[model samples]
Each structure stands twice: as C-alpha cells, then as structure tokens.
Target: MNFFYFAYGSNMLALRLQKRCPSAVFVESATAEGYAVNFSKLGRDASGKGALFEKQKSTALGVVFEIAKSDLKSLDKAEGVWFGYDRRTDFEVVTNSGETIETTTYLPPKMDIQLQPFGWYLALVVAGAIENGLPQDYINKLKSTPYQIDENQNRPSRLDALETLKSTGHSNWQDLFTSPRAS
Candidate 1:
C-alpha cells in the first residue's frame, strides 16, 4: 500500500526524504493553489522551517512522492508530528500534467513570522527544488528567502545535509550560504 505525499520543504530533496522513509519515490512536481510557502515553522533546532499558509491568489510549488504506508510512522517522526507539523490529508495538488491529486502534507500548528530558516536548511530546500526541476522563478524566490547562519559550525545535521547536496552533484551548494538575504 502506498500514499502520495506532498513535500514543499527540505523533504523535497529525494535523498533527505529517503533517509526518513526509505520507500519514498519521486512522483512529480505539483502546485497547491491558494497557499504560499514560508519559513515560519519553529524547528527543533530553534531555526525556522518551511510551512504553507493560506494566501489569496498564491500558489506553492513542490514535489510529490509515493511512500509506503508501512513507513508512515517513520515519516511522522521525521516531521515531528507530535509537536511540530500537523499531518494533513485534505490537501489537493495539481501535477504538471494538469491532473488533480489528493495528497498528504505537513503544516505547522502555528506560524511565527519573525523566524528565519538556517542557511543550510534553506540550501536543502533550494537544492531539492532544482533537483526536481521546479519552476525557475520559484527556485529564485526560494533563494531570495532570508536565512541565518548556524552558530555551531560543526552541527551534525547541517554537515549531513550539505554533504548530501554535494554528493548529489550540486556543485554550487556552498554558494548558497554566501549571500543569504538578511532576515
């Protein structure tokens, strides 16, 4: 049994998502209308993470993956469903081929506009967007999002994510940390 999962944040990265749910398989690029992606979800690391918020006439572009039902618990754990995101199954996204698909996604319980994502975290998202061939304009918007540098240079997750991006052949991944817009 499998279910479609919509990934708009770091989970959009195939390698990243696969680590959590090994059965995850990329399906297609999708768009959720009337919503916008924002880095306003408070993360366990005290940095902002991506969340979708209702916005008039806006759309959030992302990737869809088919995940095994047996791995749902692992996916929930990775998403911090207990304290972070609320798993939503009511969302409907349109694929590039103009087909409407019912999918599940994660949404923050609350939003904090003042928060900003860590540079490395945002890099994961941008790299994922590029890997999935999302719209160029959407990728540019993601790059323009403000981010803060992690004070801990040796953060394990940060190192792992950046390394994953590099290993996935994202040559300019390092440049993503260079000039993040001020939060």
Candidate 2:
C-alpha cells in the first residue's frame, strides 16, 4: 500500500525524512489552501515541551512524499505523532493537478496552540518556512527566536541549538556532519 504525507514542518529538511524512510519519494510542491502553518503548543516531555505545526486558513506551502506501508509506523514515531497527532484520512486536494490524497498531518485535538512568536520550535519550522517562501522578516523572527524553559534544560529549541553552534564559531552544522574535518 502507498501513503501520501504532507510535510509542512522540518520534514522539508529532506535529509531528516530520508533518515526516517529511506524509500520515501518526493512527489511535488503543494500548498494547503485556506491554512497557515504555525508552531504552537504541542506537548511536554522530559526534555521540554515543544511547539508543533498547526494549520489555519491562510495557506502554507508543503511537499508530498510517497511512503511505504512498512515505514509509516516508524515515521509516525519519529514525528511524535504517538502523542499529539492522530492519523486521519481527512486530507483534501492541495495540488493543482486535481489529485486527492490522504496525509498524516499533526494537529492538536484538545486546544488551539497559543502562538508564541519566539518559541524554540521555530527553528524546526524554518525549513518549512524557507521552502514555502515565507518573507525574510518572518525568517528573521524564526532565526532570532528565544528558547523557553520547560521542565528540563536539555530540551532547548532548535534555534537555541543553532545559536550554540554560532557562539562556538561552528556556524555550519551541515559541514560538521557532511564534511571531513581538518586532521
């Protein structure tokens, strides 16, 4: 069986998704019309609470990927869908090609996410924002987002991690992993 997933958050970081599902195929760029993507209250964990992706009626750009049935469960776990998200077949047509697909979009079932403009999860939201052509001002807001404290100190926002890299003068994290360091 084939499943279509609409990735609006960090999943736009292709490498991240590739790690989760090696066979995942990128289909095309699409948008969720009448909806806007925001990182808001997701849930709490030992590390810290997080802001998850939420869709409002303002349209957000996204990518669709085809995943194998065997990989869906793993992907769900990686996404923390086990807690905040409930997989559903209620997805609608967002493609100009008139293709209807069902996708696993994460949402809050209990309460609406109260928007925190500088939340830590904004870093994870960056990949999606950049892909969707969100304005530079918004991008800067994401880049400068401040970390929040939950129950733990280890669960800093993605921006905080990136800032740590910047402070350590290792601004290029991609290079740290992808490049051979000086011997």
Q: Supply the TM-score for candidate 2.
A: 0.62
Instruction: For candidate 2, write residues 70-171 as lDDT tens digits.
Output: 988888787666576666556654764656666766554444445343333434455545554555664555554444434344654445555644444446
Model 1 misplaced regions, further than 4 Å: 177-183
The local lDDT score (0 to 100) that residue 20 gets in candidate 1 is: 88
Q: How much lDDT does candidate 2 score? A: 0.56
**Number of the predicted model whose TM-score against the real structure is largest:** 1
TM-score to true structure, per model: 0.93, 0.62
Candidate 1 overall lDDT versus native: 0.89
**CA lDDT, every model vs. true structure:** 0.89, 0.56
Candidate 1 C-alpha lDDT tens digits along 43-121: 9999999998889999999999999999899999989996779999878999999999999999998999999999889
Which residue pairs overlap in candidate 1's backbone?
Answer: none
